[model samples]
Target: MSAAIWLGRFLFALVWGALLANLVWPFPGKGFALFLILLFVLLAIHLLQLLMFASAYRHFVQWRRGDYWQIVVFGIVGWFAILNAQPQREQELKR
Candidate 1:
């Protein structure tokens, strides 16, 4: 993948991490139970973001017939590739 795509993925992870941390880290020492709950919620949000990215890549691969590994290894860039995978006008007219 291109460096720009890799950078985009980094930005995606960074933004999500920052947002989740901002929401969860401000209440330190409230209680052990609350801390554990917040930790679980943060982990869940991270997982959800990953799953959403993977689903988008998978959907695009089906239509574009591109390499699956590109999506699996580079993650969000795969989805971006799909987003920018517009067929040429000549190609579109054939279908």
Candidate 2:
């Protein structure tokens, strides 16, 4: 689970780095709409992932965290994002 969370975060970091690169690159001035769109969508997914993880983090009793309700909300939203982003897979062992 931590791997999934970290992978998601890493993707977001890559996205940020790419945007910075794009900004630094002296271009012919043509806009890169496709890359921008992909980056935005990925960023959204990563955001949901972060929310889900943060929600889980709030459960640590030692942390004395607040707002358990918000965590549930974030988990729900993250699930939605994952469902939308994931490609359909064949059920190898449907019960």
Model 2: per-residue Cα lDDT over 13-58, one tens digit each: 6756776566576334455665566556655765665576656654
Candidate 1 global TM-score: 0.34
RMSD of each: 8.3, 12.0
With a 3 Å backbone cut-off (N, CA, C), the pairs that clash in candidate 1 are none
Instruction: Write down the lDDT of every candidate, Cα atoms only.
Output: 0.56, 0.47
Highest lDDT scorer: 1
lDDT of 1 at 26: 54
Off by over 4 Å in 1: 27-78, 82-95
Candidate 2 global TM-score: 0.38
Query: Residue 92 of candidate 2: its Cα lDDT?
Result: 24
